[model samples]
Target: MATQSPFPFLDDLADRVGEALQPPPWFVHEAQRRIVLLVNHVLMQEPEAQSRLARHKGSVVEAHWRHFQVRVVATPAGLLDLADPAITPDLTLTMVEPSPLALARSALQGEKPQVRIAGDVQFAAEINWLVDHVRWDLEEDLARLMGDAPAHFLAQGARGMADALRRFAGAAPGRPPAPPSGTAR
Candidate 1:
C-alpha cells in the first residue's frame, strides 16, 4: 500500500525556496573548505584509507549536486585539499537526486543516493573503498573535548535516539538486542 503525504505541495515549495535562496560565493567556498577539513580528519584516523588515497596523490575528484560543486585533490600525505578550479578533475561523482526532501527521506531510511560516476576507474575504486571503510567516530571525537565517561554517556543517549528514529522511519521495532560484551545495559 502506498501512503501519501497530506502536504504534497511541500516538496514543490521546498524546491522553489531552494532555488530562490542563492548563497554568496564566500559561503560556498567556506563550506567546501570545511568539508575538506572534515574528510581529511576522518581519513587521518584510517591509515589504510590514507595510504590508498596516497597512491592517487594528485588525482582530483569533483562532486556535483545541482549548481553546487566541489573539487578536491588527493595529497601526498594521504589527506585531501581543495583542488585548483582551473584543473580538470580525474574523477567526477554526480548525484542523480535533485529534491532535498527526497534526499532527506533517503538518508533517514539509511539509503545512499544514486550517483553517476565518471572518469578514472582506479581512482573511483579507491574512493569506493574509502567510503565503505572510513567512518567518523563521533563519540571518540567528543571524548577529546570532554571526559571519556561524559562522552560515552552523551553518545549512548544520542545512539538510542537515532535508533528510535530509524525504527520510526524504517523497520518495525523488534526485541531490543543485548548490549555489547562489556558494560552494563
Candidate 2:
C-alpha cells in the first residue's frame, strides 16, 4: 500500500498562499533589473564573450519559463539591457519543462532543461555559445570581497555540498541505479 502525505491539504494551501502573495509589479521589475546586473557582471569577466555579444548588439532575445518572461537586448558595451516592449524579439527561447522542482534538479545535476528555440538561427547559435561558454567565477568574486584563502575554503565546501546533494538526488525514489564498481557483475 502507498503511504499518503501527512498533510494532504498542503498542496492546496500552497497554491492559495502563492496566489495571495503574488509579487508586486515594482518587485518584479526590481528582480529583473538585478538579474540583468548579475548577468552583465558575469559577462564582463570574459572579453571574448563580450565581443561575441557586441556583434549581436540591439538584437532582442526573449526567454520564457512558466509565467515569467524576460526580453533583453545586447548593448553597445556588450552588456544586456531590458528590451523595449515595442520591439520584436529576434529570438525566443521557451523552457520546455515547466516545473520548478524539475528545473532545480536538472541544475543540481549540472544539466540544462530542454528549451524550444524559435526565430533567427544565427542569433540562436550565438546565444547557445554564450550559454555553453559563459560561467560566473563565484570563487574569484568571493575572493575579491573576502580573502583568497577564505574564498577558496568556502568554494571547496560548496562543491562538496553540491556533490553530496547530487549523490542523494541520484539515489532518490524511481532513480536509476548508480554505476557498478569496476569489477564484473
Candidate 3:
C-alpha cells in the first residue's frame, strides 16, 4: 500500500506562489509564520478548545491535522474554506469569526468542526468583501497557495479581515458592527 499525501494542493500551490512572487526564502518563511500565528490566535479564542491545541505549530500540522477543520483553499479570490456559504470570500481573511474559528481550529487540530462536520463539506459562493477592505504584504509561497494573484490583493484582504475583527471586538454587547472611530449612528 502507498502512503497518502498530506496536502495534495501544496505542490500546485508551490508552483503558483513561486511564479507569482518569486520571493526570497526568508520572506516565504515569514509569511508562513504569520499565517500560523494568526491561525493560532484564532484557535486560542475559542470556547472549549484552548486546552487541547496549546502546542501545535506550523503549516505542516495545520494543513493536515483535523482539529480545526480549517482547510486553506486557493481560489481566484484567495484563501478560504470549502464550507461556510456566508463567508464565501474571494480574498483570504484571517480565520476570526467565532463560529468558524471554532470549527476551523477544531478541524486543524485533528478534532472536528463542530458536531456537524459533515455539513462543512459544502463550499460557498465567493464574496469580495475582504478584497474591498484592508491592506497587507504576501510572500511568494503564500501567493502561490492562493493561485498566484498579486500580493497586494491578499494583503488588502488580510487588512479587511482585521478590520472586521476590530469591529466585532468593539461592538456593543448585543449590537452588531461597532460604529466607526468617532461617529455615532
Candidate 4:
C-alpha cells in the first residue's frame, strides 16, 4: 500500500519558500569558505587523515548537494584548500538523495546517505576511510569554551532529545522503532 504524506501542501510550500530565500552569491561563497575551514580543522585533528590526504596533494575533489557545491584541492601539508573553478576535480561526489527530510531520517538512524562517487579509486578509498573513522569530539570542543561539567550536561541533554525524537519518528507507520536509549543490545 502506498502511503501519502498528511500535509502534501506543506511540501510544496516549503519548496516555494526555499526558492524565494536562495542565498546571495557572496553569502554562499563566505559560507563555503567557513565550511572548508571547519572541514580542515577536523582533518587536522587526525594525523592519519592528514597523511592520507597529503598523498593526494594537488588533486581536486568536488562535493555536490542539491544546487550547492564546493571544490577543494589537497595541499602538500596534508590539508585542504578551496579550489579555483578552473581546476578540474579528480574526484566528484554527488548526493543521490535531495530531500532534507529523508536525509535527516537516515542520519537519525545512523545510516549514511546515498552518494554517487566518481574518479580516482585511491582518493575515494582515502575519503571513505576518513569518513568511517574520523569524528569531531563536540563535547571536548564545548568543554574548551564552557567548563567540563556544563559541556557534559549539555551533551547529555542533546543526546536525550535526539533519542526521544528518533523513537517517536521510528514508531510511525512503515518504520521500525529504535531500541530504547541506553538499553543493552
Q: Positional deviation of 55 in candidate 4, in angstroms?
A: 0.9
Candidate 3 wrong stretches, greater than 4 Å: 1-20, 54-185
lDDT of 4 by residue, 1-185 (tens): 12344456765676778788999989988998898888888988899999999999999999998777999999998888989999899999998866666667667777787889999989999989988998988888899999999999999999889987778666777666767867876
TM-score of each: 0.85, 0.84, 0.24, 0.86
User: Each candidate: what lDDT?
Assistant: 0.85, 0.83, 0.39, 0.84
**Which 10-residue span in candidate 4 carries the lowest summed lDDT?**
1-10
TM-score rank, highest first? 4, 1, 2, 3
In model 1, which runs have C-alpha deviations exceeding 4 angstroms? Answer: 1-8, 171-185
For model 4 the TM-score comes to 0.86
- For candidate 3, what's the RMSD? 18.7
Q: Against the hidden true structure, what lDDT does model 2 obtain?
A: 0.83
Clashes of each: 0, 0, 23, 0
> lDDT per residue, candidate 1, 1-185, as tens digits?
22343346886787677779989989989999999999999999999999999999999999998777999999999999999999999999998877666666567778777889999999999998888889999999999999899999999999877766665556433656444446597
Give the range of the ten consecutive residues with the poorest summed lDDT in model 2: 1-10
TM-score of 3: 0.24
Prediction 4 global C-alpha lDDT = 0.84
Query: Which candidate number maximizes TM-score?
Result: 4
Clashing pairs in 1: none
